[model samples]
Target: MAIGGNPVFRGKNFRSAVATAPPVPQAPYGQNPYGQYGQPAGQSGYGQNPYGQNPYGQPSAQPQGQQMTPEQLDQMYKAPSAGPVETGRMTYDDVIMKTLACLGLVVLGAGVTLFVSPAASLGLMVLGAIGGLILALVNSFKREPSPALILAYAALEGLFLGGLTRIIDAFAPGAGFQAVLGTVVVAGVTLALYKSGKVRATPGLAKFFLIAIVGYLAFSLVNLGLVLFGVVDSPWGMRGIEIMGIPLGVIVGLFAVVLAAIALIFDFNSIEEGVRAGAPRRFAWTAAFGLTVTLVWLYTEILRLIAIFNSND
Candidate 1:
């Protein structure tokens, strides 16, 4: 899994960190693999003898200890091995818990916005948009994952989302709920497909994603400029422009939704790769952050798509 789709996953040496567990040296006949003469683990240490003589050439006494039976040795050898959790590596559970924590903070922050006045909500939205972007960039470029930064980004994004939802819903009743439902359905399907191995992040698809995302961003920037300069009177700026009686925003928004779905697939791939590669447990925060970012973007696109589609009616 080459980390290329999600920029946040980029530069993180996941594959390079794939730690292969060294094969355990088999114990002789009645001896234990852990240690000898009832010595604790690591007592012999690597390349050092626990009995007779030490690696330092010191004459150490070999204690005469009772040895284990064949049954005991067989049972010990048959025991299940340590997993990611025991090895202090990333796991699906780690990612799920951390992602939930980040999302909980987002919900908490959004709930706070709901209690504020409309004026305050607008202010919070602006604050969140700017502050979240700064934190996102900072966190993405960091060599290691920072839980604090990722959580903060989620909270700020929540503020923005809450305000945006309120504004959109006010204009188009039930649009918010519909958009949320749409996002959930799309995300659920994407995840299921990815888990089933039907959807994978390929280099070719990633390249196409990159190009499409860049094009979308460029168009969005141009549209924002037009709207700001009063060159486009429609509420959606260039997006509101109609072609054959159909709004351009409707078509573009759908394309953006597809892009967001592909991004989610990439995010899932990143998480799966990280866990398989035995990444550090803390990198679960990275996985959580990437998922949150993609999900947030997915929700926003769905919301806009709904809003644009409603405008056509």
Candidate 2:
């Protein structure tokens, strides 16, 4: 994620949340840093040949002279062969690979829910939520990452997503497919816009995001209280209430998309940082895990929005 402010916005990887700048490559193994190449035993500099050829300069010797001295030739041969060039740490390619892995887990989990019985599906969902929560907390707090826990989270999340989608699809034809498509379209558009520099979560915007998330959470808590106290009777609880001709769900759904998309930016930022920091190759799974969480949130929000829109139609 991009750093929002010096550290606050950027600290959480606000999508600018955690990506670091480029990384330095580690030196390769077994190569003699002290001796290899044509120079003197302990010679530190690739100093000029008695004739003043440049040291760090690697251009071929000028062919102006008909013959070369043996000393010059040996020095040229001794200079260490240029080490391999290092590309900046992580890249877009890694993101693609990790994204695919995340999607695969999602599919596997979904399968478990769709074909299994209701009792089984319910049990899977419970397990998925609890396991996913535990993994997320562990990864967020641990000094080092645990690959197994991360993967487990993905698998459990898949079950949760699949079961939730199944429940929605039952009441609304093609709801699951629609939500998936909606999620893809939103993700594609967001990525394009971010790459093009058209959409940015600037410092000011991030402050607003924080404020909005807090407000939304407060509203949700209050709404839940109302439902429990018999103050609201709608299926969506407060979300099913209409405000001046507009359903509350639509209003909240739109807001949810913004929040979720920002979360995606945070996910993207983390992936970018992993690559730049040359974070352990295994951390790539953490990148995938973050993305899966955001995408699931985005998909569920879109599904809710569609359902709300259809209510009036």
Candidate 3:
């Protein structure tokens, strides 16, 4: 007797048969309902979407530079899809570590310059400026950060800064230390202001800062030309010229300290973005490089400021 129609034997036999027979198919394990295949799952379908859609269920992308949804365009234009956005791994400790490394190089180069020839130091300085500039441009444009290049830039800038410090120190023994202290104070205060939102990097401020920087650059070029042509006998050429008994260098240097402080704010902003965007660990070096550049600029200006003040006094 069959299980449906019979009694004792029927139930037992039917149960055994049902148990022995292959199990009726289940939705293929983890198979997508919209998938193309009726095939039992655990198999790839046309377009390879398991659940009748892409892995992430995103529709295939259109051509590049074409119109896209706001979200899509943002994804395309923003930093590459490396990982989740991050924030605040860049602490004062990180900055200090990097700054210490840069300063070590500064010390090394300065030691050499002090014991060796100024010409040797000057030659190295020119080399450093050139090398640092090239690497800076290269790193800025790269899709990924390069630690080697970044560290190289640091070393090069250190050589240049150290050599220049020695030259100026010949005239002013404690000026290097003074400039260093001044740079630290300026950077510290600027960072505090930026972090506290006391000194915001508003768009208007950025625009003004850019204009000032460009003007400073133009003035520097003119002054350099004047010095090279023997038109100016002063140490800083036209930059050292006096207006109302005040060296023009003093005014320019003040503006530069301010500019460099603003630049530090920009560096902070960039590092904030990089960390927030989950940029790679190596990018820490990029942050370090930028900080180094700003500090160097700050120190140079501070040194000049002191010199002008002393000369005037």
Pick the TM-score winner: 1
What are the RMSDs of all candidates, in order?
5.1, 8.2, 22.8
lDDT digits (tens) for residues 1-313 of candidate 3: 1111111111222233323433323345654343433322465432333344445657645443333355653453443322232432334456567757866775675566667687888998888889878876776556555667767777787777778887777877788889888988998898889799887656677678778888999998998999999998886798777899778888888888888887777766655554444444444555666677677778878987887777666
Clashes by residue pair, model 1: none
How are the candidates ranked when ordered by lDDT, highest leading?
1, 2, 3
Q: After superposition, how far is residue 208 of candidate 3 from its true place, in Å?
A: 0.7
Tens digits of lDDT, candidate 1, 230-272 = 9989979999989999899988999999998999898888788
Candidate with more favorable, higher lDDT: 1 or 3? 1
Model 2 over residues 1-313: C-alpha lDDT tens digits? 3443112123233233124433453435844343444344565334324444435655536543334556875666556544212332345665578768777887799888988988788888888778777776665555444667766777888888788777777768788888888899888888888778777756676687778888987988998898888887775778887899899889999999978887666555556556655554545555666677678778878987887677656
Give me the runs in candidate 1 sitting further than 4 Å from their true place. 13-69
- Cα error, residue 205 of model 1, in Å, equals 0.7
Candidate 2, poorest ten consecutive residues by summed lDDT: 5-14
- Which of the numbered candidates is closest to the native, going by highest lDDT? 1
State the lDDT at 121 in candidate 2. 86
**After superposition, which runs of candidate 2 have C-alpha atoms over 4 Å from their true positions?**
4-44, 47-89, 311-313
